[model samples]
Target: MNRDTLKNWQSRIDALSLRERAFLLLTAGLILGYFLYLLLIQPTWQALHQGRAELESLQTRLTALEIRSRDLASGRATPEQERLDRIAALQTQLAERESRLQARLGGILAPQQAAQLLQSILAQTRGLQLRQLHSHAGAPLFNRGSAATAAGPAVGRYNLTLEMEGGYDATRRFLQQVEQLPWTLFWDSLEYEVKDHPDAMIKLNLYTLGHS
Candidate 1:
């Protein structure tokens, strides 16, 4: 406000009685607090409420799916021939999935390749620093058929753990790059902690299946 108008308002406040000024101060404080809640706290609470609701819905769906899967496996009330037919169909689907998985993965000794690619991407990310890159021993994928045989084509899953510290945007870009790689990757887990504002520590565990 211009000087004269501001002074007029100040004089009017000065003319108020002690109890009147206290009441005005309290009213202003309440208004400020309400605005602060709207500007800062309300959105966080709304997000948390919505997230909890979604989680509950997902949990309900997951429970039903788990029950169905158990029935498929045990076939407690199913006819003997029907159970056998379901088994055959599941085995066929498994074989087809395995075939497609093999086609997507054409490399061997995947851990080293994964590490190299991750390092390259990390280097390219401006605000990210790599603290650790750990590669675990490969776990072989067994053939799923009437008979479990190792004589079939050998395939294994390579596990890699990546630890880094970076800004959120840079880490998000790095993850996107990893996802867009030519080979398929199974995401095991991801942990992100923010000890400092706008910067976070990230731990990512990933695995890929390929020739042993």
Candidate 2:
């Protein structure tokens, strides 16, 4: 029937062989899969990566905050301990104040009171003749008042100067009497002059402190 037509068809079929058809189909399938991945799977993978990064950042921030909180908690001091320390410091201050008050109480004495004390001392003197007696009263160091001590009234202090003339034995007896008196007197100065008589002239300076 038509030998020419058969030959043309056969030549056309040979141009597109089975191997070429298979290769063309494979290339078309690979292109379609790449488009699908770009549209759906690639976006999903990007979103997953972003979400993982955000989660990691949040975790790191949380860890840092937790560590800071723990550090702050550890650094906190208890109120009880702080109060106890304050109490101890206050107690020490109180004790010091009390000691200072006691010392102040011990150092207080006054002048007129010292004169009366001298009279008492004279009463206790053994054999002294009441010779020419002189007394110079100085300003009182403190008024008749309480000492700085917490327990008792403050006392006052003063300086007193006294002079007397008598025998040596009588003067010694007067000094002994002064030392044995109930109150305290500081013998600041003493001067004695010898005369042709058996008796001697004596001068004395006294510092006395007394309470009101």
Which candidate number maximizes lDDT? 1
lDDT of 2 by residue, 1-212 (tens): 59999999778767897998788779999999999999999999999999999999999999988877776689644567567767666656655654454475454444556677676676666554444445554543333212223334433445666666677887887887777765557778888887747767777777765443
lDDT of 2 at 30: 99
How high is the CA lDDT of each candidate model?
0.81, 0.66
In the range 1-212, model 1's lDDT, one tens digit per residue, is 89999999999999999999999999999999999999999999999999999999999999988987888787564568677878877767666666666665664336567788889989998899999999876766755665222224556777899999988999999999888877667899999999797899999998876665
- Report the C-alpha displacement of residue 6, candidate 2, in angstroms: 99
Error of 1 at 116 (Å): 0.3
Report the CA-based lDDT of candidate 1 relative to the real structure. 0.81
Ten consecutive residues with minimal summed lDDT in candidate 1? Answer: 146-155
